[model samples]
Target: MLDLYDRRIVASLNSKYIDSKLAIDTLALALKKHSPKPGLLLHSDQGSQFASQEFTAYCKENAIVQSMSRAGCPYDNAAMERFYNTFKNEYICRYYFKTDEELNLGTQDYVFVWYNYTRPHSYNGGIPPSRVRFR
Candidate 1:
């Protein structure tokens, strides 16, 4: 969900069905479109998703520097933590999803189309993520 260069969220979905390998591959694909230069700093906590062999290898192959926060330090990943909190509060908190499919679709719609194109972000000078990127 972290858009590294833009410092905005790229996408989010509610699904425990995603595996670490798939997450890694998805990130690589997104990065390909947004960051082709490589060598970007990808900071993440030591979650299995970030620490998976596929992810590590992708970083290595792409010339990205993978930075892991120290264990037990919430502040180390404050941005992502704050993002999740906002996501939950704004979207997840209000909805009672009856099924995984519903949650997945709703979250995808919020984070991708609405959040990116319509929602104004205070942190980005009150512009939507899409405007900040394209304008």
Candidate 2:
């Protein structure tokens, strides 16, 4: 999942049942010394991962409001759609992966070193995601 504020990936779980573990891990990483205010919101699609019982508890514990897109409505989450489109077009579609490790490493590089630290986003005033302030 991408944090809309900085476009930083807080979690990328590839599993059969993305349970509360991913949510806990993501919240831990994203909220490191950056505890959000009471009304702070974390928006996502209405995926099972975001709606799991563990995820709900974690959000309650952190006092973060969970905002989900309406069912069957992708337009409500346009920014995230854009992010995934860019991810697929720029990275995934361009490569022929020979192994799972190669794909994982490539995705890590794209998200961390390139997307966050190097690539400048027009929406971010031509600054990299790492330089943008939280919303």
Candidate 3:
């Protein structure tokens, strides 16, 4: 869900359970929203979902290039590492959720409105990710 260029999160999902189907669905939804071009690069860790045949076929059909992080190497996906750290430190740890619904809503608000639109990134010259796109 990380945008390599602007460091934006294109989409996210939360649920009681997750699998390849959920990953594929989120990817489809994200691409629909963004209208990705051919040769678009989608980088992710070597999770089972990302490695699944269904997800691989979808990416291939859509002309998206897939790059996976190396095993045991966090630096290969440093952007996601930084993002997860920020997310945990700033929002996830600060919230006290009593229900799944509440947690989902809070995550949605934090990712979409606060993280993408309001929070500034040092990599983006202190501008929000939504305002710092290269294209």
TM-score of every candidate relative to the true structure: 0.81, 0.77, 0.92
Q: If ranked by TM-score, best first, what sequence of candidates would result?
A: 3, 1, 2
Cα displacement (Å) at residue 70, model 2: 1.7
lDDT of 2: 0.77
Q: lDDT tens string, model 2, 54-124? A: 88888888888889999999797887788788889999999998987888789888877887788888878
Model 1, C-alpha of 48: deviation from truth (Å)? 2.4
Q: Runs in model 1 with CA error above 4 Å?
A: 17-19, 133-135
Candidate 2, residue 102: lDDT: 85
Q: Is candidate 2 or candidate 3 better by TM-score?
A: 3
- Number of the top-ranking candidate, with TM-score as the measure: 3
The better-scoring model by lDDT among 1 and 3 is 3
**Model 2: lowest-lDDT 10 consecutive positions:** 10-19
Highest lDDT scorer: 3
Which of the two, 2 or 3, has more lDDT? 3
**lDDT, candidate 3, 12-117, per-residue tens:** 8886656788888888989989998799998888989899999899999999999998898888899988999999999999989999999989999999999999
Q: What lDDT does each candidate get?
A: 0.75, 0.77, 0.90
